[model samples]
Target: MTLEAWAVAAVLYVFRTLVDDDIPLNAGCLEPLRIIVPEGSMLRPRYPAAVVAGNVETSQAITDALYGALGVMAASQGTMNNFTFGNARHQYYETIAGGSGAGVLRFGERGEALEGHDGADVVQTHMTNSRLTDPEVLEWRFPVLVESFEIRAGSGGAGRWRGGNGGRRRIRFLEPMTASIVSNRRRIAPHGLAGGAAGACGRNYVERANGERVELKPCDTVEMQPGDVFVIETPGGGGYGAP
Candidate 1:
């Protein structure tokens, strides 16, 4: 199992423990629990095989399962966890970042999709509410550089209850750097509720620091060298409640 799945499992155990005794007090607390996994998922690993999409896909499946079990809200826009690794001080340094899902409360009585998706927490579960201030730290430590990093203006889906904003991050490298992405919601738009619209899609791009560029899809893992930059646009949150 990947670290993300393991973390979820740990949280589940803790949540059960905390509410086991108090469950009878609140009927709402007695929802059933289930785990969702795509067939042949990495989470279903056997020592012999590995699935590259396991990390991000599994996390998303689990999140959807949580929402369904609770009978509380629609699925989240989706999760994004793009990773980058490079050599720094003769050692390897890595970083993972992504966007957040829409909130259930935002949807009115009739659930709807969000116009713009919001960013999510990092792997550590910190909500993607803010921005990363500097790429200099990563550059100083690793064989990478920051080309451009900013929020994608007007990328948010418009609706009665607008969706959250996703971010755009660009990274350049002095040497070849490895990248792995765990992102979704490109095919399925961020759902809305109570007369709202779906959110915009997430994307990744690889381009030269100077002129040419290439766009990468979700779950794309590649290598980059000097003068090449990787741009990651995070997903946004779904809109809530009708305007």
Candidate 2:
């Protein structure tokens, strides 16, 4: 099916599962929602398109577009930061989490104006709710070593209500393997709203056994040898108001 069709189906399923009212799970629930997919667009790619990344990356873009159209909030980190590695023997895939966008400002109980609500930190939004693999489990299951995993400090935008921070993960290969990454928000930072500041852009890099360092594109596939380290720095959310 098309990316747009898949997204609509996933969303409708979630809505149907969440409603507690006597409404039945049927096509009628989707009547109030209008889904439009433009031809040749990212959400609706033409035939022969490589849509592997659309399931994770483009879904977040669709969420951002919907939020923008509704004037609900600023844009979040529009990526899922998918990473994969394997040899002929085994393969593993993972989706690293990023930050969500901030909501509009509101008044405090004391009658004082407050900044917008802060976005979620290092989480899967929209239709994705998958959790990160445990470091111990990942290390035991693959020919890799977890060097470090932590939040990227000060990566969030500066504003009255600051955005949530992204995550940083580094892994070292124990043996030669093939690696692939599918992600976004590398060139353009997450957008801000109401004069807020934009969030930091994400980065990906590889450290070779020979002490050479190379930056990877947002979407890329590469071959790796032993002692190679792969690092991913996810994007932070956009701030909601002026600082």
Candidate 3:
């Protein structure tokens, strides 16, 4: 769904002079997204599917595709999409995010955030721009508890123009259940532009609901039991200029 949206938007932007009025596109213009669910899949519901998982995953894909098509920027850290569900009164939750790429502009250039914070723009390519869901909604719909959610500090790459920061998500399960996550930017650092610095990588940790200690990677899908906790450290954007 996201890809189609972007494709259509791209066509419009390129042919604006001929089709629509030639309007200078400013930052924060959300790229359109489109999706087609295969028959008999989770998305192929009689009515509307939950859409939370689809939103998260599709967002990542759209971001990646945008980068690939535009070719004006470098590769991003990766996608940060997660999913969690509970059944039989059991609860499970997972949260994750991706990293940003190096600035591809001039040596002393700055990235466009489109929206959000400043610094390196949070390029949402074909593989990004997803949604896990709302904590309140998840807790009411599922059997999980959202411990905390915020942007991880000092995670962005260091440079003259620092990279954008990723996010952090924490979830605690009340009963034994299952959880899963799909993310990247661990192996491939976000590409940089000119002399810009690369962005930070992503990380994942497992803290027991009882406060135990356990660490994991950005990409992993596992089963969770009662009193289990999960923490997701999203990737950051790259620097645009030299420090």
Question: Per-prediction TM-score, please?
Answer: 0.63, 0.85, 0.59
lDDT of each: 0.52, 0.79, 0.55
| Clash tally for model 1 | 29
Report the C-alpha lDDT of model 1 over 188-225, residue by residue, as the tens digit.
66555445445566777788766877777776777777
Q: Please provide, for model 2 over 14-122, each residue's C-alpha lDDT reduced to its tens digit, 9 standing for 90 to 100.
A: 4564466778777889998787778897777888877775567776776665665544566778898989999997799998877777765555787454645877777
Candidate 1 runs further than 4 Å off? 2-55, 65-77, 87-99, 104-134, 241-243
Of the candidates numbered 2 and 3, which has the greater TM-score value?
Answer: 2
- Whichever of 1 and 3 has more TM-score, that candidate is 1
State the lDDT of candidate 3 residue by residue for 98-169, as single tens digits.
446543332223544322222433334443445566778887877667888776676666654566677777
Lowest summed lDDT window (length 10), candidate 2: 10-19
lDDT of 3 at 60: 47
